[model samples]
Target: MIYGVVNLRREATLPLVVGNMNKQQQVIDTVIDTGFSGFLSLPSSIISALDLPWSASDIVTLGDGSETLFDLYAANVIWDGQYREIYIAESETEPLLGMALLYGHRLQIDAIEGGSVKIEAL
Candidate 1:
């Protein structure tokens, strides 16, 4: 099981440990975005700091129906106590944990400030 907490903004925020094969790692707070179909989204600064490798670019439609290109980067994350490889989309917004990463897992959120957030493997 994975544990997290709801922030003051009522976002189901969780900590994600991103790392590379060289052992460089950083724990980032990410908001769970159910509307996002991708795996993860990270700020450019974090990607630069982590030295993550460039993967590719893809067109993504925004909430406003506008389409934009996003740079994809190769990354590894510690999920449910195991290391899993995932792609990170470069975005200027706050880090987002999307549905692709939550696939096959159960998510429970209290939906209040300082409330509990839990993710369990099926």
Candidate 2:
């Protein structure tokens, strides 16, 4: 099981421990965005800081219905107590935990800062 807490902005956030090929790691707070279908989205600055290697490119539609190509990177994240490899999309916005990462898991959020949030594999 995984646990988290709602942020001041009322967003459900989780702690994601990301690592680069060199085994360097950093723990980041990521917002859980159900609307995003990708595995994860990290700010370009974070991607650069972590020195994640480019994996591929993908076209994604934005909330405004505009399509844009984004760079994808390969990185490892401590997920559900295990180290797992996941693809991360480069974004200028806050890091997001998308549906792909939430697949096969249950997410519960209280929708208030310091509120209860829980995630667990089914």
Each prediction's TM-score against the native? 0.97, 0.96
Clashing pairs in 2: none
Q: Which ten residues in a row have the lowest lDDT in candidate 2?
A: 108-117
lDDT of 1 at 103: 98
Q: RMSDs, each prediction? A: 0.7, 0.9
Query: Candidate 1's error at 6, in angstroms?
Result: 0.5
Span of 10 residues, lowest total lDDT, candidate 1? 15-24
- Segments of candidate 2 deviating more than 4 angstroms: none
Pick the lDDT winner. Answer: 1
C-alpha lDDT of candidate 2 relative to the true structure: 0.92
Clashes of 1: 0
Q: Which parts of model 1 have CA positions greater than 4 angstroms off?
A: none
TM-score of 1: 0.97
